[model samples]
Target: MAGSTLDESVTAFLKNHASNDAFEETDPVKASQKLFPEIAYTDTEKAELSQWLITASHVGSNTEDAAKAAERLSTLNTHLSSRTTLLGAKPSVADIALYQHLASVVSKWSAEERTGEQGYHHIVRHIDFVQNSPLFGLKLDEKVHIDADNVVFKIKPIDAKAEKERKKKEKEAAAAGAVASGATPTTLTGDQGAEGKKSKKDKVKDKAQAAGDAVASTVVGKPGAPEGAPTKKKEKKEKQPKPQKAAPVEKPLSPSLIDLRVGHILKATTHPNADSLYVSTIACGDPPGTDNTSEFEGQVVRTVCSGLNGLIPLEEMQNRKIVTVCNLKPVTMRGVKSCAMVLAASPRVAEGEDSHKGPVELVNPPADSKAGDRVYFEGWEGEPEGVLNPKKKVWETIQPGFTTTDALEVGFDVEAVPQLSGEGAEKKTGVGKLKTAAGLCSVSTLKGATVR
Candidate 1:
């Protein structure tokens, strides 16, 4: 029960018995109801039954009570055996019913020794016999804990409810202390409360210091005390302060070197063979979409070949613009080329599931600029391509009409450019309005607006 518990196996066995049709008519619940029709199927019956078993195993009065319970169990098992075709063969409903009763005693036999009854021993022996037989479909190693009182197996000292109660008590104690000292209780607000909650370890050290002060005061007699009240006091010892190490300083980057712009993904597709790898097409602006509409405004149609093949299907990435690392050099992976890096939110993986790792993004950026566009804090327009200086180019070839000439990255993260509200911006032509799941938006004429 304490380490590497085995209650899961027992639970699985019980659950199977409850659901299996083999126990349809001769189920324990049905049998108990039939025999004790006048007893009334109350909540008390279930609770009492559980208590009886636990009490009998832990501590029962003399041998008489133990014998009576053992006899009742034996009678129940005999009655069940009579109802089914085979006592341990054919795997009938009665066998399932008897098995649970037998397994319960086997699990509780450790503390049963306190009962000081041969009847308890007899019960365990019989359960062991049934379990050892292959026909019964039971195993002795299917251990169950009879002593686990705590349900949540916490591995840490932190418990939410316990912490809440402890804090409430501390607040009351602090208020009481302030009253005794004839001082106003300190009211923490804003920075004060924030500072007070800073270090629990420091709080403990302060409490120890207060205790030492009280002890030292008791050792020193007051000036008005009787002459017979002789006082002896020792010097207060100061706690030794440990030497502190200075933290290393981090190098600050020059503000002029920082780039700050938003880029979008132009295209997406999964690799045909690799579990990962998505090929894509990206446009800095002018992403492809359904038709020209203002609703599809401020989108990028850049291509991105990424490692998100299996996590997201290729068809789902079409015409969807995504943020990207606008400064990375385009590199060729698995024979497919990529231009700028496509940025996306990190993937979330649930327990017992595969990871969904993707790209990263900034909290906010300019609206019009998109994927493949470098975000610089301040820089010249028309920046050079391939920031990372990779060995080969990212793209294989530029295709016509925004279609995948070779294999598509086959995901969202790119689209056509939209109208800019700023002055001097040209009204780009050849693009059309596109309808999306979200609503109407602008799109590029080069590609049909296929929603991923």
Candidate 2:
């Protein structure tokens, strides 16, 4: 790098930006905004980029605490697990900082460290994405070659709805604990005065106990009974339930909440009762004893029922690497419990058109992608729900944005999804291609088709 033919101005520009991490408010969205003025970043995004930039910049600090650095890396990994870029689908100066600082260290990570039980899988994923995605276009002399088969630990997909509820309960419990201890109010669950008062459950329990004590006192002290007479029995009081709280707001609709995976079809058979459905044994990267999964030909696989029996040939459906929606609630079709849905691309049907036609093609994963590999729409990447509610129609809501580019590559069009279009340039536009860590998801011959 020292002997390169770069001019003095170029060298100075690089040096100044490298030193900008030293600036807190360069922990400054203004600097990042100056770097890329086209992206109209919100205050939240600016703050995020600022903090992560500080973290990324200080990743190799000699004075930083060892545990703190490790924690920051883990947090970064978790953050990237559901995002394509640091700013959640948009590239930023912070991503560059992360790549510049940790690429060397990530390159040397063992398979266990890269994807083990407590591994930084998302960091490895970020490194790979940063170096390879056209968004960043970093030109390194040597790029880290990530092996798809070397992932030692398979992290189960997160359930967004469940996680939200868990957090909500934790918040309420903390508030309750604070109240119980007579601490100053911190979290606001509802009305401030009401929260200050004894919780309904606590008040009810205290009243019940007091009444029970009074009854027991009188029953044991009755003088009408003989001296040796047995005491009257104490009646049991039934426990009262706490008042139910209203449901939390629904999670925002996004492609990231749908768990997509690269699945290997082990075998395909015609559904016995349903002639239009094909029951398939697919290895979707589930561990042994996963619900609705059975060992088929020595592989733990899910039994998926797809209506491709008449649309696609039996041979095409057999032994193929296709994308599967892994989180939808398993449904029984024609006496067979279908565990997952196979994604396929078909021509867009007009209002009066027949939905099930012969021109359907399986959405293809990269040639090197393995079963259980995380698949996501590029910009809309994030953790998916553990089990998507069929009743809620999450898929139906997000499916309209699922489409194929002119090149036959599957993607999610952000602008087309009005529900996800927040008030900002960053969220309103972009066609994020569907891909796994390996490469783009595509169909053999289905250009400009609808992918679901």
Candidate 3:
């Protein structure tokens, strides 16, 4: 009845019962054709079905293989959207073979590999239909629960004594083997020879004797005590603590250290040596129509170099109003000495984005503010240093407070701005407000930007 041939007889014998005539075809494709001859398949459909069968049968063997199968099936499903089976209109040998193969591997696939079920909707639908068809009597068992705590873990406890003995024995055996091979055995010391040969009880006795000796050594009065018998506990001379020096107070950084001033870019040109650098002559000191009697009465042009070649266009740099640190020590870059540092703000680069390039805009001051006008917060003043030391970290203390609001105003923390009065003076009064020599310097063309 179960012979591997298309013409095999399926015989049935029963008492007082008629024999049923049946034929068995071991080959599924041949059987499908013989049983359902009405379901005709084209040559192309047959070839495609064979490929799908091979893929489904071999898929889920590994993660890589499963991914490939999923992609292939999804693509096929997309191409054959409205069709019920691999071939149009009716189920054929191809459908039966594919369904059987897919059903076999579907349960074994991991969650990532099973995405094909959702991606290939038509294929999933066909699979469901074939699995539930009356012609096939396949009954899958209900899913079982696996209790994690029920697992049995096998672990061997470590025995230090046994390990030592095993190693010693291995060494002795190796030496004996070498001697048997016509090599002379090396003589071992008494201690080395006794290492593997000692009895368990003798080792225990030696351990007990060693522990007793250690206890006797610590006892104040013992029979075999050393010459310093009844060891006198040296009275810890109550540590007359030396007068602890008071911690040196850190000097507060004066706000005047930052010589913030408004400057106009008089002429901008590319730095000759560096590609991503720009050298510009900035006009500082005093604007036109102002008092021409002050120390910086006339416009003083200072050379400034900035790395803004690709960030801003050269045409826009001309006559642009910018904030500058006038007191920072001059540094030679690309053979040109940069006297002052220009201030600019850039948006914080988001996580996972390329940080090499982004928009960098100049920090703008008020329109009416003249070049050389000092920028300061109200109620905050200090003896501004002529040149800041590169090592003093004067800028490091104040740099964190620099920020910009959505309004594009570039400023610092009002609290961090050093008060003009001493520590004894009113500390809380006139705490928060930004100011400059001309007026409050808070306004910019670029909105929602932060000053770096």
Candidate 4:
């Protein structure tokens, strides 16, 4: 029969509660609820479980009430297990039927130990006794018969020897099949045999090969091509130009002490009192290091004073480490104060793939630019000029053009200026400096000056 038809008997048991005289019939839930109402439901539970009753009334067709019936039956089973007295001094078939109602009705929590094996074992014990009993309509043998008195009785004989022989034959047949196919035999049942395993292995290999081809294409420019093989079509070679003089070999630049460690923003929330201000907590440190822990101490907590406001979502900043100016003075915004400024890329295109344009491009790496690192300009050897704001702990500009507004407008104009390194005739425009006139610019860093 279909699974729904099998549940008809269980559904009829729950429907008895809606009748005027429920106790006149053998009602499983009513009996269990009266025997143990405290265990039936809790004080926190609502008394108006009529919706559930209506749902259980038409359960076979009602999808919504099907879930409720299953839950109620499962709870009844738990109560039956904990309180042994409900089954009386000798466990009766009625108790077993009550427990089965829970297992068959409640479909949720199917995998849970309390409702699965434990519940099954207890019900099976009662089924065994009822099957052995000679009581009319009580005994469960194999074929159920109703006598002239309209009484039910069953006759089922245990067949241990036949069950064992059938299982043994199944095992041997599986082993012989494995040998004939030249595959390793496994006693594990279901879809865990060599044929199933081989299919899974082939699937995994195909997936891996596809992934490798994709990676190879990214590096070599074509699928199945050797690594580093150029993908683009080559153009005809042109004659090379020679220089009059050769430049000196450049020295390798050293890593900045401060930039060695990285900091990530942990949380960001707008400042309660300030409209333009944001309160941010950041964590900095080298990922786990040597036993000393001080190397990681380069990791420190710092706050960011950002104008991003609504431009960048707070969640976007989490775990991101942009450059942070650690040695700056704290400034008060509205009423709350900010510790340092966060270094970020200039406003460019946003992130994502739905744009009419292709993938969003990253800002090009400057000819000699390293982000998050301090830049020091070439200067005469002497004390640098600048007033240090103790409250701010930052060096204020003494030279002609160095203000917040000037810094903000630095990228607008580009102009040529005399080389600061004393290269007599050669003139190069400061690549990343504020151009004040047709041929003048100021750099992010001062020439040999210390701030903070």
Give the winner by lDDT. 2
For model 3, the superposed segments whose C-alpha errors exceed 4 Å read 1-251, 286-299, 349-356, 414-434, 442-449
lDDT of 3 by residue, 1-452 (tens): 11222221111111111111112434434554564543455667656545554554443234456668657667766544535456554455445555544654554544333333354434544565445432222233422122223323311222345656988999999989988754432235566555535676987988899999889786845565477679766788787879989996555675556888888887899999999899988876521222111112122367789988999899989977888888878888999888888878776567897543757877777666656656664444544676777898777666545656555566565444344333545654333233553355554465544454
Sort by TM-score, best first: 2, 3, 4, 1
The total of clashing pairs for model 3 equals: 2
Q: What lDDT score is found at residue 217 in candidate 2?
A: 84
lDDT of candidate model 3 versus the reference: 0.56
Better of 1 and 2 by lDDT: 2
CA lDDT, every prediction? Answer: 0.38, 0.75, 0.56, 0.36
Weakest lDDT window of 10 consecutive positions for candidate 3:
10-19
Candidate 2: deviation at residue 366, Å? 0.7
lDDT minimum window of 10 residues, candidate 1:
397-406
Per-candidate TM equals: 0.22, 0.49, 0.37, 0.24
List, residue by residue over 272-309, the lDDT tens digit for candidate 4: 87665567775432112211112112232455556556
> Which residue pairs show backbone clashes in model 2?
25-28, 82-381, 82-382
